[model samples]
Structures are given as structure tokens and as C-alpha cells.
Target: MLAHHTLTGPEDAPVLVLGNALGTTTDLWSDFSLPFRLLRFDHRGHGLSPAIDGPCTIADLAGDVVELLDHLELRQVYYCGVSLGGMVGMWLAAHTDRISRLALVCTTAWVPDKGRLDERIAQLRSSGMESVADTIMSRWFTPLCPPDAVARFRAELLNVDLPTYLACVEAVREMDLRADLVKIDVPTVVIAAAQDHATPTELVRQTADELPDSELYVVGDAAHLAVVEAPRTISVILDDHFGNDLT
Candidate 1:
């Protein structure tokens, strides 16, 4: 099924597809203003998208993007993703030729702690999102993050569809993209947050190192959701990485 999406920016420019992190919608990339034609969408079970009955895998998530691209008649696009979105990006880049350049932000090749994820899932199933909201919020942004920004993301987290969120979490729990790293041959940039406890800087670095051709850039004073906590810094980093030449 095609995920709900919106396309904006100049009609004749290169296309850039923006993927959202877990628990976020297309609105996650609302802060970005770049030269390319931008496409942003909600993942399965995310904002404005339909929920699935059971668990989904990374390939299943990536398949949604493929369906969306095909529906839009887009042959190729620059892909950028965060966290869960980044995991989907890796699969798309490795399994399909639709992606030209790739940017992975605040993501990992695999879920490093499946046991912890299992515990999180169990907690969510029992007490609801409120049970894990505070913990997720802590990893999302640092104490120095703007209060309003933190509040906004926390609300977004609370608003997520529970069943869908749990299914996606299961996908992450079962994910292992380490072997897919070498297959991503396109120009790639891996962005990390210095204070991200979710996917730490070192883990992000390992992802970059494994990619055949990639560069790593770490943003300071931010956590997992750096794009929201440090919007200006992330915007600049993205523009520098994906802007300029598309030939």
C-alpha cells in the first residue's frame, strides 16, 4: 500500500525523499527548506497512514516507499531518513536502484539490544505509551533542548497508533542490516548526534565505517531526535550533503 505523502518544492528540481523516524510523521521534516523537490510521508501505522494487523519488517517498510515511488511515477530520488526511516532507506538503497544519494541520520544498522526492545514492547502493551513516554523522551532530546520542542515531540509520541507502533517496534527488534551496508554503493552521509543514547554516536560511526563509501558528521548538544532539537544545525548538514550537484 502507498503511504500517505506530500510533494513540494520547485517542480523542475531534483527530487529528495524525506523519511520520518519512529513515532513521527511527515511533519518531522517541516523544518527543512532545500533546493530539491521534497517528498515526505508517514510510515505504515504512522500519521495519516493505515495500520497493519501484525508486525512488519524493514523490507516491508521499504516496500511501502517503492509502492509510493511507483505510484508517483518517480524513477529515482535522493533519500534521507531518520531512525526507523533510516533503516528503511538502507533496505531501499541495497535492494533497489531507486535511490541516488542517501543520508541516514540518528539510526543504526540493527537494533543493538533486542532484549531491551522486548521489554519496551511489553511495557507499552501493558501500561500504554505513557509507560514508555518519559524514557523515549529522554533519549529523544537532551535537557538543554528547548522546552517547547521537547513538549511537541512528546505529544507526537503519545499520539501514535499503539498497535502500529508496537508492530514497527517489532520490526526494529528483528532488524539486522549489518550485511546490507556493503551493498549500498551510492554516495552516502551518516549523521549522528553527540548525545544520542538511543543510537549512540559510536554505533552510528560503526555504520558509517561499514558503508563502502560514506562520511560521518556528528552534531553536538543533541540527542536521538536532533533534527527537532537542533534544527538549524541539521538543516545545514543536510543542505551541505544533499544540495548543490545532482548531475
Candidate 2:
């Protein structure tokens, strides 16, 4: 069974479920939790969730998400997924109509570097989480941040499960939802970091083009981890876009 850590907020409050990039805990969405009922937890084998042996596919992650939503008894939710989390949301939305609104941040339908992703997963599984986490975390942002922010990010990422992290890498790499994007019939928002090394501005713009009522924002002076790097800006935009006030 997949057990999810849920944030209990106002019952009438609009549901906001958060999903993080692989290798990081729900802490990746800490900034969003303050103003909403955040459902933040480890994926099947990431963060506090126990690592289990199985074929971890993007479909598996999507299945886990369904189980979590059912566990929460939420019939509808606004899904907020970053990187790997975003891919999961895309998968979920493609398969069902449970997601009322979808917000994908700093993630792409596909991983730009497939070779490095495979190598990194192998390194994480064999060499352990600590061995490759530092190297991977360094890619989280560009070289334009204060030391403290970067240091904090590094610490959190290192705590992720090695095998689960690799599984997430495959999810990001293999996902291609351009065909499915047209079928997405929800209010979708795609936020991209202007200086992001992971998902470039152009790709985000391309993703936006495929959607119907999608809004795109380029958070200034931020990198791949833009939501954390600039929470206030992200929070305001989220509140305006996906929050209950908008509905």
C-alpha cells in the first residue's frame, strides 16, 4: 500500500496537492503549504517512504498518486507538480479528470539529457544516495544565488532515496505528452524559470502553445528550482492562478 502524508487545512478550502521533483521530499513544496492545504509526502520510495523493490515507471508514480488522492477522499484537486512531479500530474490528468487545475513548474515533458540521466541513476543505486546527490543538486540552480539557498537545496536533495531518485529520472526521460496535451481539458499553468538549465524557456513556451487555457510565467532571476528560490513571487502567482479565489 502507498501511504501519503497529507496537509489538513480548511474542509471547504480548495484542495491543493503538491508533488516534488524526484530525489527530494515534499519539502520541495514547503513554500506552497503556508497558504493552502498541502498534500506533501514522499513518492513510493522517496523521502520517508520505505524503498521497495519493483518496476518504478511513470505509470507507477501516477498510480501511487491515485491511491493518495483516494486515501485523502478528495474527489477533485488542483495538482502542483515540479519536474518529476509535473510529469506525474500530466500522466494523471491524461488518464482521468480528477485534477481540477494543473500547475507544472520547472519541469518538461521529457528530460533533455538521457545519457546523463541513466548514468546518474546507476550511480545513485550502486554508489548510494550521498555519492551522486551532491553532483545532482548542483544542477538544481544556476550560478547566481546566495550561498545559503544553494546549501539548503543540496542538503534536502541528498536525503532522497537513490533507487527512487533513479526511477523518477526515467519518468522524466520517457514522458512525451505532446499528443496528450490537446486532450487536457483543465485550467493549466506552466511556470518556467528564466535561467533554468533543466527546462529552457523555449520548451516551456512550446508546452504552453499546446494547451488551451494555459498561462506561462518566467520567474525572474531564478533557475530550475524557481519556486523555492523565489517563493513569494511563485506564491502570489499561484494564488492568482490556481487558488480558490480564482474559482
| Model number with the top TM-score | 1
- Flag clash pairs in model 1: none
The C-alpha stretches of model 2 lying farther than 4 A from their native spots are: 33-35, 244-247
Candidate 2, 221: how far from true, in Å? 1.1
List the candidates' TM-scores in order: 0.97, 0.90
As for candidate 2, its clashing pairs are none
Please, what are the lDDT tens digits per residue for candidate 2 over residues 1-247? 6745757677667878888877677667665544567777678776677775655677788888888888878788888888788888888887888898999888776655688778876786787777875566566776676778677767777765556666666666676877777878898889999888767888888878888778898998888788777888888878877764454
Kindly give the stretch of ten consecutive residues in candidate 1 with the minimal lDDT sum.
Answer: 238-247
Q: Which stretches of candidate 1 lie over 4 Å from their true place?
A: none
TM-score of candidate 2 on Cα atoms, chains taken together: 0.90
For every candidate, C-alpha RMSD to the true structure in Å: 1.1, 2.1
Question: Model 2, 227: alpha-carbon shift in Å?
Answer: 1.1
lDDT of each: 0.90, 0.77
Q: Write the per-residue lDDT of candidate 1 for residues 38-67, one digit (tens) a residue.
A: 999999878888888877889999999999
Ten residues in a row with the worst lDDT in model 2?
27-36
